[model samples]
Target: MVHAFDFTAPDSYILNCSTLLTELPVLERAQAAKDAGFDQVEFWWPFDGNPTPTSAEVDEFITSLENAGVELKGLNFWAGNMAGGDRGMVSVIGAEDDFAANVAIVVEIGRRTGCRAFNALYGLRTEGQDPSGQDSTAAANLDLAARAVAEIDGTVLVEPVSGAEGYPLKRYADAAEVVAKVRSEGPANIAVLADFFHMSVNGDDVAAVIEVEAANFGHIQIADAEGRGAPGTGSLPLRDWIDRAYALGYTGQVALEYKQDRATAFDWLSHVTQTA
Candidate 1:
């Protein structure tokens, strides 16, 4: 089996500790990533309210990275809350002002950290406080998003969630359409972060999307259909994802993001194999 892309072991994977708020003291997590042979790592908006970490904190984090020999791929500020906002709080796309503020912060964080991308949310609406209006807001937000994407030294990706795990996330919205909008108005830096779990939830054929929407994919994160865990632990065919990624010309990081009691990248090793 000739693999499409060759990713590194101990290379960067998005370290999603957003759920584990108590554990987000970045130095400890980054050091763990370094020890696991990971070349790089990411935080989901490590700081709130602003994009760049304070000069002192950024310097300290960078020093930690240097000491650990860890590189940074990028960061994710999934809408306003960065990662998952506890107790059902999330960003509403129609709340245009808040949306802009959050993404701007995401951009700033990426710029200062030497990170590569920002991830924001178009959250879910259940009983209709204008779920349908999100795209419009997302579109309206794009002009500003364009400004951010164009000037942003890094890239920005629109991440729509599957409404699982108690998070208020938008479901089955047109990610392709939104991304196309981003690309048109601004720098090509804006793209999509394809989460395989969301694919499974929405019955999206991820491999097929990869074939056609390959160029749109800026990042790829994975877990199985049952309980977001390492690839191959559930229904997602790990081998197929690799094959399709290769077939589709995607040679980017396939970050492993799953929930386990302890923070450990090694847990994904047996469940995933990157064959050359």
Candidate 2:
């Protein structure tokens, strides 16, 4: 309940620079958020193609946030070929080494920018690989990520990605189970990245999810169910759900992960940020 009133205001949450300013250059999106009146930002892995990016690239990425005068709030550990159809690789049969390689890099980024939550997307099912095998791989990789993130006083996030065919963790229980399994193996900082839009699309009672799983959520993201637009553009009672989440004991950054068409005018932010 630390940020309970934040449900009524914009400053309390971080803008998802990656998703918000997709039309802008990746390195320049942080500045875009800052220019748009946001003081904090989050992103998917900045490097889409390179998991083990060069140190120079890492420095530039960190510098982007620093230069933009925005605090880095959350980041995803690389999920493979996001544009080429891969949702993630941590749970894939032969991608363990690649996933492992990105752990330190992600942790190092977190250390540099003081970001504390790192999302680990569960990969899609293989054509012939057994379900159990993918599950096992996901658990092990999540455990590994938990250990690394814990070193920096960070949390490893498991998210339920929606509209993703064949991907695991499509439900709140699915992601929660992964977090529980990781915790059972003894890592305490592993938690779910509760994304209301995805949960809504998957036909869950999102408010009930907050009521039941609030304590286990490390972060939250929001977008309307209809067309995944800004809050008022669709039917979601966003303010109510946000308030519900705060009341239920979820104290974490609420990221704006909604999509935009060519024109990215975020007028809703001003309305939300206002106080009487």
Candidate 3:
């Protein structure tokens, strides 16, 4: 049960249930995380991409965390149809209402779970749509979400994603630019989500980003570069990158958002500690 990294506190790292432990039902992943020695967990839009889920569904989602004795540290606002290739609607032309409606739900979740970090993914570019208009829409939606989450003392996150074509925000600078635009309008608590796997895949210098952009990062997620698997599965120097970020003063939980079977997903932890 030894962890890969010697985190100073139980809450230092979060197991992203949305990606890990896929063999079990979504609700059961929390308990699995707890059993595997994680005190906190995070998720993508969990209700089948439904923005306005039923009251019972919300209750059940909350109950799962409570029963597992794990904190819901991070959550994603509804992005449209992830399986169908929709990254998010914050910037999409026709999905403004859906994005707006999801903001309230996200706030409620934050209020109830003390989850303070919310990631809002920017949607893909629509055919025949102006990029400028999409950027404006993204900024506005992010502002609204930032304001709503701020009521709960939460920060909204903009992440650069890879592997999805037409999706904007492919680099740390891209996301940071969007964050800067939103912040320019007014004071809203928003920051860039530094997912190392995505940034590296998109050809960003991960070490340089950690060195220069640490102050602008709200959260961090990690998976190896070539395959997006566990830390040691690919060529990424993930341990070094994480250490560098911490050395540069990043005070947030690092999320384990890699793809692997539950049985062997965490094997890298021991491998890392042994090598270190």
C-alpha TM-score for every candidate: 0.76, 0.94, 0.93
Candidate 2 ranges with C-alpha deviation above 4 Å: 6-9, 271-276
Best by TM-score: 2
Q: Tens-digit lDDT track for model 2 on 226-272? A: 88988888999888888777777887768889988525447665543
By summed lDDT, the worst window of 10 consecutive residues in model 3 runs over 267-276
Judging by lDDT, tell me the better candidate of 1 and 3.
3
Error of 3 at 241 (Å): 0.9
Error of 3 at 236 (Å): 0.8
TM-score-best of 1 and 3 = 3
Candidate 3: tens digits of C-alpha lDDT, residues 1-276: 222456433345798998998899998988888877788999999999898998899989999999989999999999989989889889987778988888998899899999999999899999988999998888888989998898999999999999988998899999999999999998569999999999999999999999998756899998986888988789998878887787777877699999998777777563222111
* Residue-wise C-alpha lDDT for candidate 1, range 170-221, written one tens digit per residue: 3323665677766676556667778778866776777777777765677887
Q: Give candidate 1 misplaced runs (Cα > 4 Å).
A: 1-8, 12-24, 48-63, 81-104, 126-128, 164-173, 184-187, 263-265, 268-276
What is candidate 2's CA lDDT for residue 150?
90
Candidate 2 backbone collisions, by pair: none
Q: Give me the overall lDDT of model 1.
A: 0.58
Model 3 residue pairs with clashes: 4-269
In candidate 1 the C-alpha lDDT for residue 68 amounts to 68
Candidate closest to the true structure, highest lDDT: 3
**Model 3 lDDT, full chain set:** 0.87
List the RMSD of every prediction in angstroms.
Answer: 5.0, 2.8, 4.1
